[model samples]
Target: MSDERSLATDRRGAAAHPQLCAGRRARLAEAMARLGGGVAVLPTAPERQRNSDNDHPFRHCSHFHYLTGFDEPQAWLLLEADGRSTLLCREKNLEREIWDGHRVGPAAAPAALGVHEAHPVDALDKIATDKLANAPAVWFPFGVHEGLQARIDGWLATLRERERLGVQPPQAQRDLTPVLAEMRLLKDEHELGTMRRAARISAQAHARAMRFSAAHFRSTQGRGLPEYMIEAELLHEFRRHGAQSPAYGSIVAAGANACVLHYAAGDAELRPGELCLIDAGCELDGYASDITRTFPADGSFSAAQRELYDVVLAAQEAAIAATRPGARKQDAHWAAVRVLAQGMLDSGLLNRDKVGDVESVIDSGAYRAFYMHGTGHWLGRDVHDVGEYLSLDEAPVEQPDGMGGRVVKRPSRVLQPGMVVTIEPGLYVRPAEGVPERFWHIGIRIEDDAVITDNGCELISRDVPVAPREIEALMRG
Candidate 1:
């Protein structure tokens, strides 16, 4: 596999655009060194069949790709405590290449991927068994792959059988998810660059959808496009800007359909006075950007729509303002909840008699009637990235039976620079008793990707307009 085409060599003997991948591996190795010495194995995602002969699009496992920049399926990475990295993958085969595509197989993987060693993927079980014997600890995310777990179990059993020969299995088994997740939680400069690009492309896609809705609402022949057409416009913009795919399912909700949180766009017809809510984003270079925008299909908002839309927008603004370094993770959420609760009271969506003041409404859980979902989540390689929110504060204050307890002091994590989070505040009102008829069937959500900075936060999706006037003007144009 050591073809001239495989090596990304330059005049100075440095690989081109290698910082993002190579630097990440170096950092992970450093982190591994900090932990007790051992060998950790990570495998890429496996391909799944879509039908009898076809396969779904392959996506590399986020953790595996973070450690080793190999994107191909059926590949495994090994991290030794001595800062050595090895890759085990399918060997290059010209016959397979003729039918499928090119493969930078094991022969050239070391030079191509900057790994210390490379071997055929078929040898993984044997190699792994040898590496696992007499180890202080074996770090791997358990339950991810049953096959890998079985292999580990086999190695341990074999080592146990070799007790007469003085061979010993690993002393302890540690879960690697927490360690890798903590590393991934903080974005480096390279990850941030990719995320910014993803956000920009996603924002452009939303703008395209808005304009497409306005132009296709009513044609000269009096024919209108369905909700799926607007969804197509979003896909077009995303691909045009080089996005690999949408971060998640594109929600193109029209009319009452907007009230559905994860509405899937279909043949639903777009009406003139109905509000369209699109929650779509693009994934670029493995990073994900999430955004949502709500606007009228006819290029102008109705009075009732504007009233509800403004509330959601204000809530999102309050949430974004509270997303800064040193602020608790729940601070932004609570800020958004307070604003939305107040908006609900003002709009008569929540009755003062039963809901009482905003504080009482929040405490009594009355606000769940309208705002049910969380304001936002951690955003990164995966749409909903992994990172624990709770910090070790104190033990829970339980009842005398020690059941149905409440935490006396539960501390949330403080925001830090390089953390990217979403600020999505929404109001989904269904037809119910005590709800105003004017605001019924109205669902408005305003979301933006915010990157925490030293002073405040930066909204990467700011290019897409969220204000009513700006959305209308963009649609009109």
Candidate 2:
């Protein structure tokens, strides 16, 4: 299908329900009003050429989409504090439409998108300059789009040129990122519904990949199964379930490759006994769902693989337990760390004689060798969604510096209802002198998307079996 047709199909429902975007814009405008009124300019992401006339898939800016719900390129949204919205979009070109499929031309934009006004993209310079004149503040996302600051400067320069004509440029320039980030951090009913669907699709994809790995390994006697093959299965399942795209590049690491975090799906053979770590997700509508599962290739985990998998699973459980309203975000990481540290000590991954006890191991950073990255990150529109991790209003508190010392740092943002996070705890055991050989080259990460609730956290991506026996049972089928 043509790109424009596909985009239209994807957003048909959203276009019909204009209140979602309208409500978000109202909230942002109210925020601007609180800051004493201003004009906000936001541009959608620009399309980039991949190589030699071919272009990468176009994705609208999350912030822009959050406000406008428009997906086309060469578009900009102008929001005024008085609740007026103006959209500058590409003009309808019959010639271009022949190749691109459809354009939500300026004539239909107001009614189609529920914006107050619409104009062709070329009018942004003149319109923005006019809007900025006599404004108390001009708000735009700082340091996001390349050349955005320069463009704003150019607009301000134009306004300054007309200073003698009683044209007054904005006196204050504020970043819109923080405002939008705080807004996007919480998922509304619409966003939550979309995310739940995404999580279900991603869970199914992971399950499909697991079963394919076991079935292929057995059918070919462990000869032809490759990481990309499993990745293909994931992509297939994602699209099969109507997901627009993978949330990020799928990580389909096999055996030792799993030790390297962020390993892209490659041609590594999926050996029978070694574990496969599939860290992947799917993007449905504009929301994202992230999930990771580590499973054995031949259906049953090896003794060592199962041991580490159990530890990572337990750590994820602890993290999930801590993901509730009113709990600080870092509380989940600390909970996961405590479980992982204890598991490492008991499993001999960390020598108890050398690292002392779990607390000592944690304080001394001895657990860094096996478990490196944090337990989780915010999950939403973007995979590593835009939201401040630290609390803005809270005072700094003294916490362990990980070196048997104390340091003052601002606490993480407190989890609240409607917040979405990924509870991913991983252990990558590389061959080291004191590390057990049995645990070497084992990398296990169990992740699930959790939605913070008033009662507790809801694991949205649990359709796939997490237990060893359950996974074995699924693969056996």
Candidate 3:
């Protein structure tokens, strides 16, 4: 691992950077105060059962983890308007600790996580009820956690019972998601550092999978190279480079499987002339890095594959050029669409006689048959990270709906420094009437993580090759 010092320490045992979490909590507290003073409760994700007597791997909630750097299950955080924070976590049971693993019990949570106070998990109802009494509002993420609304209602109900004693329940309930979403839209220095490391690791994994596929194909004369085997290679590289886990399910699509979009790694064999698309990324220190690269099963691409790959690569390049400070978020998507719409006509995927010009193709949405999905999305703690796509402060305006109609909509957000996004453009061709025969069963996507800078966006996931020649040279090595 190059730049090992830049990587965040594994946070499995304890909060790796309590000060950063403390700062985030303070910001939330101030935001709540600005919103008329309230108490906010956020619960971490619960452990889920996979099968009889078996449990799935536990992943902490992104919002909760953002506020408190704690990764334990069955934990909750309370942030008050006065910059006070409380943590409710599992109690220390030596036997359970032996069965599970080390837990930062309530006794140590205050100091370990930089919270003002801590209590056992069982005391949530009592403590929350007390905190909510006479508060103007209670804030929580609506439509997020199941059973959370009922839990807050229970607290309010408890306070209602003592109405005669001058105890008052919260007068209103507010959604905390929008407030936090705005705060998390921009990456701070600490988050940017961690995300950069994750991008590096995921890029290395993609390169490793490429080399593994090419070597296996050459040695066995295009035999015994399954998609799952290549997926395993990616996983191996991610773990070896200190990633906690894959950001999402790995997509190792071979040949026609690539057209399925969300295809999981399966037993599909890597044929010599076919393309294999691997869309995988790693999650390090809670931040995600998503990268996708399509390469030939052998060391070289077929003529049809190379042509389509170049088209998709050119689309991604156009998208990348439009991802910079002051540019609207939709600018990149439209830029890519313009390039792809033209490619579709030039390649005979869409007949110019039928689709007319590129503008007509875009206006009629005729290009969606081959190129669908947006050019990119916000990338951070979650793969498709939480952040509003539309500009909230601006008034809605009527715009052309691409079908010779008008619709009212808010404009997409304007790109700004410290924001992170993914620039992914793809063309998936399935055999159909009027489509080029040579382009059948061919799919190509080029994705990279981009960090918005003062001048332009920086491509963080470019450690792997994107050009046809570079990819061929890399696989040959």
- Among the numbered candidates, top lDDT falls to 3
Question: Best by TM-score, which number?
Answer: 3
Candidate order by decreasing TM-score: 3, 2, 1
For 1-477, candidate 1 gives per-residue lDDT tens digits of 332222112111112344456676677667766877778878889899999999998988988877766778899987777777788999988998898788989988877878888999999877887787787777788888658777677878888888799888888887878878888999987788788878888888899888888887655333556988899999988886677788999999988898999999999987888888999998877789999999898899999899888888888888988999999788888899899889889989998887699878777768888888888899999999988775645444321111213345556678899999999989998999878898888889999999999999999998789999999999999
TM-score of 3: 0.97
For residue 329, what is the lDDT in candidate 2?
93
**Runs in model 2 lying further than 4 Å from the true structure:** 1-13, 403-405
lDDT of candidate 2 over 350-462, digit per residue (tens): 88988899889889888888888888898989999989999899899988765557889998888999999999999998998988899888999999999999999999999
Tell me the deviation in Å of residue 409 in model 3: 0.4
CA displacement after TM-score superposition, residue 186 of candidate 1 (Å): 0.4
List clash counts for every candidate, in order.
0, 0, 0
Q: In candidate 1, how many clashes are counted?
A: 0
Between candidates 2 and 3, which one is better according to TM-score?
3
Cα lDDT for residue 118, model 3? Answer: 99
Higher-ranked by TM-score: 1 or 2: 2
| Candidate 1 residue pairs in backbone clash | none
TM-scores for every predicted model = 0.92, 0.96, 0.97
**All candidates' lDDT scores?**
0.82, 0.90, 0.91
TM-score computed on alpha carbons, candidate 2: 0.96
Ranking by lDDT: 3, 2, 1
